[model samples]
Target: MRVLEEIAIEDLGVIRTARVPLASGLTVITGETGAGKTMVLTGLGLLMGGKADPGAVRPGAERAVVEGRWDLTRHPQAAHRVDDAGGAVDDDGTVVVLRTVAQGRSRAHLGGRGVPQGVLAEIAADLVTVHGQSEQLRLRTPGKQRTALDRFAGAAHAGLLADHRAAWAERAGLQSEIDDLTARAAERAREAELLRLGLAEVERVDPQPGEDVELGALVARLGNAEQLRQAAQIAHDAVAGEDMETEGSAVHAVEQARRSLEGAAADDPALGEQAKRLAEAGYLLGDVATELSGYVADLQADPAALEAAHTRLAELGALTRSYGSTVDEALQWASDAGLRLLDLDDGGDRVEAMRARVAELDEQVASLAARLTAGRRSAAVRLSEAVTAELSGLAMRGARLEIEVTDSDPGPAGADHVAFLLVPHPGAPARPLGKGASGGELSRVMLAVEVALATASDDEAGSVLPTFVFDEVDAGVGGRAAVEVGRRLASLARSTQVVVVTHLAQVAAFGDTHLVVTKSAVDGDATVTGVRAVDDDERVRELARMLSGQDESETARQHALELLESSAVGR
Candidate 1:
């Protein structure tokens, strides 16, 4: 029972400012062309977050604004969303929505807080559904026709559709996995072979951490062994006297100097200090001589060990060239290859698993699709019967609607191809709505379908539909057909709010509340228009104006009165 309580439009098109009060039943807005009746629908669109046009602003105005107040006690989902967006609902369960268009930009506000325009659009989806001439064009599309049928089918068909969609998604996922695995099978096999060869080589070598570094040092030492031995022998000779020659050796010279200084130590204390230093030098020289002799004895050039070190280093170098620049990097490659090899080995198993899952999903999708087709077939019968009944009252007697559900390849929606066929008269060959119905007939059929869907929704959910706004629903219709369209709208209004913009006197007469848009010059001679509710004799005058060119025509006024009386009786 969501209701639009009020709408305010300012500086939009030809209307400076207008406050339109809405009621619970049928409200028809009527006016002559260029009187700003369409502006009402435009304002409503703005309140619902429709795209704003800068050209819609009045000449001197900087911007345009449209605001609406809604009673949302019955729309808990919308109320919850508002609360989630940090908006407040009034104590009486009402919310304010405003849309402002300025300088090619549009802004939306919920309650008192600014919100994204999409937020208002989301709320509007559950609050109102606007049907205009464009919808008539859409009704001719097969997809739209199918959607209408699903909507009319209510929750049962929706459940089946949901199930079918889930199964289809599962099947699609498995099929994608299978395709990927199959396409890459040969490439993966090659990758696995390379990884296996690398892993085997690394395992055969089995190099330890830092092993390459130790081997490099050993090789350098072995390569320089002969040079090192010669250098050591020269140093030993300089530090200590050679076995056969000791006269000029450093140790003997220091010993003679120490003896000479000891004899003179008694004469001067500085000379005693010098003697002690020379003695320390002699002792250090002796220790160096002993170590030198031992080092020369141990310094045998081992060519075999040197050759082995060189050979081991060459082996490590070969491994580094193929795998990594260093031993650690080569080891890291081996680790990575091992993991990759595992995935490559499991590819066949994964493909088999996907195939099995795909088979399972195929079964589930087929079963769900069958159930969906059955449900649609059942609902199509009820929908056809209901629309047919509605058409009979819309002045199309004996015009039967047939909803044909046929089998098609399974898709996201299901396996049923739903079409609406029209049999214009008894025994008349049934044809698709697009071919069988004229423009006026199609309009009536659309209206009938809406009425049928609304009724079906009410019966299935025990809930009222949203506000239904029909912009010139009686288009291409005249005479009793227009009157019947009005009557149907009036009847739909009994359950929910219905707003219609029309110029037909018969349709306007059936309104529970009638508003007329009038245009005139103001104090400064500027033309402006606004909407106001008209009733009693004023309503009769408005209706008369619609019926004929003159509002004061005696015959037209009489006819308006009779139309009102007849409408009341029909109600």
Candidate 2:
């Protein structure tokens, strides 16, 4: 079974170094006043990621360390989480958790790897449940009472709560959407009008892709048409003169050079190669001269065409200034605005649809909340009967607990509030637990409720926690009542490990394993404490000390022996 195998502490408070071994059944830790019994729980608190106090460190020590070993063979999920955190569980299914407090800071480790203190807290939640005086105080709150009732309502009831929460979340989302649509109606209308006007302007201008750039080039050429024609004429005259025989013309000069090179070709082969190059050059010059003559003739400026182009370019520029840097970008903006306007126009229809959906969800939430309330009320009757039955054996004869489920405003957890009331005797009226119970009565009532829950719950909330630790939960109890407290603890231990730090020998006598915290003086004035298991004879002496201040008294020893025999028979 999953259990806390051992806890080892070093230099914490009065404890120098000690290892407390635990087992499957009831394990009791007992010691004299100021003998460092609380230090044992302090070490466990550190392992559970509880806040570290620098004052808890033993004087002259650098740091205090607490380590715990857990058997996780039956808890694969917890083991998997450790593995995910880069820690390893041993072959025998044991995981080691260590916490160290130095100065004012604390550090935690799982398996062999370092981890956040919160990691230890999360993993340990499923491994142990610690019940102390503080827990009894917390049980008085309304929130804790409701949680306890819901847990006792079982798994099927839990599913109903989940469905209700989901429905509430969905309804909230729809309500938010409807609120937004209503709040921003005027703003959305203004946006739609602006988009419509802009779209109309863009449609009227209707600029084409690359149209502005193309028109710019045409305007430049037409503005300087006369100058361009003059340049073409001069270049044409230079390449192919006024007439073919014109002196110093490019065609005439190349023709003369070709003839001279051909005449010398007969005397030298190099001259023939030069003559072929001159002939190719003459052909290229003739082609250029023809193109230049044609260009001069066709290059005429048209005022009407120039005016039309200027007007179109200005229209495109207006569109660009308002929407984009270019005609194409402006066109893209127009297309997007058209779609946005359509969406704004449909807002009314969408809001109507959403409101209808929200109304439907309201009905669903109300129906589910009703079902949840009914289930809780039914479970309340059974839980009250069960806890009242347990209180009879915990020294509160004729006492009974009554659970009340009342209606509340519907929310994620459903529309119900739960409160636990106590009736001290048959003739007394039932009052809320906090008001009707004394300190001793409250402790027993809390214990009875816990025992009832533990035996009744088959859900993960009850089954996953493998160990329970009680720190003087039997406070203000003695004699017969003390024996019953021990017996109930022993009963709880049968299903899961139970560790009790107590002063009652009646309780200690029922432990399957008994450990006592012993104190000794060191050096001149320093004191150190250790925890050790007691055998049957040592247990008797320890019990005697608990019954009376003197362990050597014959009568106290006899009472201790009798307590052990009676508790054993009860177990």
Return the top candidate by TM-score.
Answer: 2
Question: How many clashes show up per model?
Answer: 0, 0
Per-residue lDDT for 72-139 in model 2, tens only? Answer: 98888889989988888999999999999999688899999999988888888778888888888888
lDDT of 1 at 36: 83
- Superposition-based RMSD of candidate 2 using all C-alpha atoms, in angstroms: 5.0
As for candidate 2, its clashing pairs are none
Best by lDDT: 2
Taken over the whole model, the C-alpha lDDT of each candidate is 0.86, 0.87
What is the Å distance of residue 54 in model 2 from its true position?
Answer: 4.3
lDDT of 1 by residue, 155-174 (tens): 76777788889889888988
